[model samples]
Target: MKHKEYRRVVTGHNAEGTAIIESDQMASQMLERPNRPGVRLTNFWLTDQTPAEYDGPTETCTGDFILHPPQHGSVFRCVEFMPEDPEVMARLSSEDGANAFAEMGAGANIVQGGRHPWMHRTDSVDYGIVMNGEIWMLMDNEEDDVLLKAGDVVVQRGTNHAWANRGTEPCTIMFVLIDGVTQAGGGKGIPPR
Candidate 1:
């Protein structure tokens, strides 16, 4: 899959900014390598990762994600996001018990590590896939972290946890941030924040 040639559709929209784009044919035949110039979100850079006291805990889960948008000419997108830079995130990632963080607003890589904190909501739902590589999810009083690779889907409900990229190269993952907070178990039946 060269330049937008694969098949994956991932976009973002919110109060801060609004952007919608896919590896559609329009993008496939007209996209730059390493840097999708004309396309938006060519870069997902985060500015911080700080911990807070509004979060219950994160669960340990792993998986892969191969994206394919609506257009046939669209390209494929893949990448895993393992809390690879835990050391750095340890200082930046949220830990104040907040609901969750919105790295998308900063275009920042949640795995790169930073002072990013949680968003503090009633229920925070994140749905995505493990494009590549593997991640070690850390949880409280949990057995062992879960291992996920390519073509795997993962969901994080109620809990306090982060990620650990135990793989070689960089792992990519796409996520959809749902509003709400943990209710019964961790983030179980919790309502949106």
Candidate 2:
């Protein structure tokens, strides 16, 4: 899928401590993996620690685009989800899902026998907003699903879930993920600090 281009404006302080526009341009880091066809992720920014430092690197989205955020930080990005092909979906197996997660640097997070092959867990509190089109959010429950349209918002705690774009057009969602601690001490991605 062709990911949507978003104009990102970053603000910072100049030499004299005056506010300035650090960067104002279209985000160019669109990640589209063959393992997860019809899905594209565009990372905007990443913070490695709380009370984020303002005098850090201009571009913090370096390195691999893993599914999880930094150990004690946050990640902001947008995802484009195209309608799934039933034929392709039916042919996929549990190992295929694990392999896909592995491609994203999170093989252990994949749910082997979940409701959907793309079902996976993340150790972050995600704030997701449906920016365009519509999609369905599937949880651990097989029968329970939520349909989200433009302007809808979902606060997803560290949980096992998957997204499905049942609509004909592609769905665009912006997500802000903050590292969190789970009841079982910590998750595989983000450890308790």
Candidate 3:
């Protein structure tokens, strides 16, 4: 289940008012799920607030990947899911694996009181681009699952959903999550299914 390494290029303005490449290297902020060994996440960039002009070198963001989005700004990340069999999916949904996933920072009962282990909702509008392979986007009810292929884009509003890659190859998707509030309750939490 080896995946390609992701490279990130960051730019900034130098003190002499010149544009400079702040960083050009592989993304280091990566997390791997122990239970689902093939699940990999790489956080590229995060902004805690609206960005202002920078007069110094790029500062390392100290944000952690929470199940929720940033309160005021956004986060850009990429996820890779290796092809798995039914047995692997069963393991992922197992109680032990689910608990481990929650401990790994997934939202708590974020989707209808945690009825589904991988189904969770965040308080953000997400723009997702399928970078490689194909995957399925499963909604709360599971009736509207959509298959997306490379180059496909999905606008994921604040909703309870999960991603599944049932193909034979790995799937990669880049997502940008922007803070948002649900209109019904004017809160960051989505309504229960």
Candidate 4:
């Protein structure tokens, strides 16, 4: 599989309190899907909180990074999905594929029991920008599935949803997930933190 490289440049303060480039390098982590051929994920950056200042070089993140939603003040990452052919879709719809996907989701600690095969909900607001190709965003309720093309953006709240690529080309999406809390009484209120 061809891997994608993400070059990251980080800035920090110098001794005289002047901003300078702290580090610049290509990201090293590239996660591949076992069940779904051609699917890959590259986590470019992550922060535990809304950082007050640039401390130093970003920490190297290991292991599965997408198991759960971002915590309070946290931000997740960007992932790319390769378009699935009919064979791949059939495999994904089979029992073995379902089990494999479930295991993968478990490793990421995603919430289980979505209506679709990979349906799950997160307690965060996700900003998704389609960088290439076309894909469908499947929701859990009455809203029609949204077909997103390159350059389209979707603001995803805390909702149960899944992504489907019915085209013949790969789709890349950049996502920044911000932590949020669902208001009490199910009124769609995210109260001030």
For candidate 1, write residues 1-193 as lDDT tens digits.
1222344343444445656442232222211222111111222211112232112112111121111121121112233342334454454334321212232222221223222332222134456587665666564424645776767887766344455565665555655434333444554353322
- Greater lDDT among 1 and 3 belongs to 3
Cα error, candidate 4, residue 157 (Å): 0.3
What does candidate 1 score on TM? Answer: 0.40
- By summed lDDT, the worst window of 10 consecutive residues in model 1 runs over 59-68
Best by lDDT: 2
Q: For residues 57-128, could you state the per-residue lDDT of candidate 2 as single tens digits?
A: 778887888888898999999999999998888888667889988877888888898888899878889999
Question: What digit string (tens of lDDT, one per residue) describes model 4 on residues 1-193?
Answer: 2546788777778889998887788877666767656667666666656552347445535556454444655444667777656665653433443454555453232335444455656667889899988988987663778899999999988776778788887788888777777767675743433
Each candidate's lDDT (Cα)? Answer: 0.36, 0.86, 0.73, 0.66
lDDT of 2: 0.86
Model 2 misplaced regions, further than 4 Å: 185-193
RMSD of each: 14.5, 2.9, 3.1, 3.8
Per-candidate clashes, comma-separated: 72, 0, 0, 2
Give lDDT tens digits, candidate 3, residues 40-133. Answer: 8888777667663344436444555554456777878888988767775664453544465575465353454333446766668899999999
Model 2 per-residue lDDT at 134: 98
Best-to-worst ranking by lDDT:
2, 3, 4, 1
